[model samples]
Target chain A: MEKKVILDGNAVAASVKESLKERINLLAQEGITPCLATILVGDDPSSETYVRMKGNACEKLGIISKRIHLPKETTTEELLETITELNEDEKVHGILLQHPVPEQIDERKAFETIAIEKDVDGVTSLGYGQTAFGFGVYPSCTPAAILEIMDFYNIDASGKHAVVVGRSPILGKPVSALLLNRNATVTTCHSYTSNLEQFVKQADIVVAAVGKPNFIQGEWIKEGAVVLDAGYNKGNIGDADYESCAEKASAITPVPGGVGPVTISMLLKHTVISAESYMSKKSATL
Target chain B: MEKKVILDGNAVAASVKESLKERINLLAQEGITPCLATILVGDDPSSETYVRMKGNACEKLGIISKRIHLPKETTTEELLETITELNEDEKVHGILLQHPVPEQIDERKAFETIAIEKDVDGVTSLGYGQTAFGFGVYPSCTPAAILEIMDFYNIDASGKHAVVVGRSPILGKPVSALLLNRNATVTTCHSYTSNLEQFVKQADIVVAAVGKPNFIQGEWIKEGAVVLDAGYNKGNIGDADYESCAEKASAITPVPGGVGPVTISMLLKHTVISAESYMSKKSATL
Candidate 1:
């Protein structure tokens, strides 16, 4: 028997934005406008386009968007100072720094500049540790979104073996930590990992985030395993070879339409949550 | 075919302490007094003994040991304030709070209070994250000691499967993360883990840290797996059945002789390192 299903990224993201309208309205009534500050440096055409899309999404959701654009020649100190200013801004509820800044600037410093409270993108190790240790805090948006999608699909992770390829601080590492928090035994594989196929074959759930175009072969996948390919490579190529893997996998998320849309939606949701947390604190004090 | 080699914890610790004295002398010539602060609450005889032993170790190594004794009635707020003060004090380099504080106090709060820079014990998430992410920072004493022991034995961990039993934040969690950083494929098992025997059976290296007596059975170990037991339970029992496993394993650390002495040695080493870092910073500014 053959099965067919279509995934729509934009429509799913739009639905999430619509769902948050009421919460945004409630906070607006309380005079607390949730604000997100996006810092973009050295306009890579792709980064510029992505930031613009996010800014547009924020507008549709009634979240105040504060856009900061720095030139390519901006020094690391200058970028850090700007981020520090945003961190101190009580009006700002969330901070997002569009990644892949100029090679000269320290990207990690820029990401860490977003205070733990305002780290809507949740790029800081502080944010990661909180989630990894099972403390109550925001997770990195993409990882949280991946979990949200899994939960939405009713995938049970309890006692499952999860193999996460790539251990980038943002997505793969935190996601593996999250899966561990949910009682799934997790193994993180990187370039140093020995026998990648052996580890991948043992996974009940496979999250491929290596960004190498179709690096995960279909033969390595265990039949009926859940596959999440978060890699958005050239021409929308994913980390997994979808054609062969999809045939054997019980459930799988397609590249462009799968994790990408959920990630954006999660970022929007974080802005609203940050605003609510700010409001709750204000009310508690009052 | 019999080896008559037995290790002594205190003597091994003394040897490490003596080796560190040269570094301590170099720092001293630069006007650095390596300081280690030991905070003990209540009068648990065992804790008192341990703290005193640390202080003595520091003294022998030309390090300054500051012992802070708080009453059992100390509030969590009081303890937190004390730790915060130590964190800010330029003179104080490393902070070690004796664990298992009074029942009324929050242990997590106590751990979190230690400044990331001053947390030589590596109990805080900041320390754990830095260690996991491969940053140059102090790891929890026991785990660091385990590494030191392994290195001393000249064991190559590259491409090896290292299975770590137990998932305590201090010893087990940090050790697995450390092993992973060393290019060992790591599997972290805890109370909730199922088929743990299977994971243990497949390891090139096995670390038993569950703190339960003989939690690891001898037959499950691969014939030539390197065994590192960090368990210190009642009656000098380790998680692994030492006699049975030792005969089968290529290299094994006996219960009392294995990891215990190295742990104390590493703690003192961190104290000296913390002090040296502070001293250099002060000298640079001066």
Candidate 2:
């Protein structure tokens, strides 16, 4: 049996973080600290846990993590005000509004409030457009992570058939655009897509982002195709049936240790980038 | 032999114009005329013809046409200054910088300068992003025209497999995003795509936007597919071979009188839409 390559997220993430250290040190010498302001609405336990993990990751990289937790009843106006303050704060390098804000709050409106330069999470419409146009400063972290992993493993997307399942604004759509920008033939499939498996069978690269565990069957994967599962569902399972998919895949990402870790690392990396850009601009003007 | 339906651009364009007449009249009653400002740099005969045709189209619709012709030696700064003046002009509802400005000018920068509200041609990066997000006020005229034809012919894009050849920023990319938003499974294929025919063979609908004449072959199209040719090459030829494709297509748009006419109509339509929006905002303040 031929040994399949395990595209390890931890190793990829370590490589990314390892790269940022030198840049982070360079910023420190300039008396600058890359700061990320994470705004979390309401007290969903998972959201809290995710927020803490992000802050810890930033601290570990010598970056500042400013966590702003709003009450469940926070209004859209209130949230926008908070984002505006962050946008104006010279110390803040990036702003991330954790997904799924409480019902009353207008989520998209909050996202739009993030200044373009500081939108490290790449949640704004302008960022999405720039990403599609192949000149985005910070693409959504998960999508960026997927590309980073592929780069680490030397998986060339050019001239390949990349089928992306799901069309979430932050995930599926942007990733498809990114791949297409890289010269891959891209097919964007969603819930309304019929005969989805047939499309999957044609893919040289499969990106599973449907948010449902085991949604993609092994039989759907083309032989020797690279599979990057971006879904993290309940019980540490991914969007694809790992065991069966691994059997057919030339390279596969394991769920818990796959795309998740690298996603946070990308967020950190973007912050450092933002800080570097800010310092350069400040120096140039002086 | 089964007869194929000819998706007539003249008929669809007339319908769009007819619908806009009432809105144009409503604005006229308020003593306001919708205006489009078209900027042409240098004397490219084809571009001059296009600009004149657009200006003539605006005049026929009772919309004011403002034409700005610059010399070949015009700098990017000069073009941007012109766009800025028009963007600030309340009378100009839409602004179009005809494609392919002189090589010295930065085209994308000029496109970006068109105020989002006045970007009726949908050339701006923000407009493209908004179109991808499915809420853009105005999409690129050609892409919008493709959707207009589909709507006019009662062709539903939902759940269909749409293969778009070419990945041009304004045409191919926006159309793919439009179709995806309509719940169609969209594949964006470019020159880099290997086995292009196999992908085209699977499409329920084929959109040919590649600039080459007769680039998409008849045999590559799936049986009973709807073909939309957005390409208008030399001698009025489209991207797909008309005779061969029409033989296999259930419905097809002809090159000369197909997407071309409707594209101009969409520009007219978007200008009217922008004018209406402007009026509503004015009335609210009053």
| Best of the candidates, lDDT | 2
Model 1 spans > 4 angstroms off? A1-19, B1-15
lDDT of 1 by residue, B60-151 (tens): 77778889999999999999999988998887889999987899999888898888889998888767776776773898988998888777
**Model 2, runs deviating above 4 Å:** none
lDDT of 2 by residue, B9-90 (tens): 9999999999999999999999889999999999999999999999999999899999999999999999999989999999
DockQ of each: 0.56, 0.92
lDDT of 2: 0.95
Instruction: Write candidate 1's Cα lDDT for A1-286 as tens digits.
Output: 3353334445556677777898899998999888889999997999998898888878877888899999999999999999999988989999999999999999887886788888889888767766777783778877887787777667778788888888788888788778888888777777878899998888888999898999999899988788888888889898999988787677788887888988988888988998899899989999
TM-score result, candidate 2: 0.99
Candidate 1, CAPRI quality class derived from DockQ: medium
Clashing pairs in 2: none
lDDT of every predicted structure (CA atoms): 0.83, 0.95
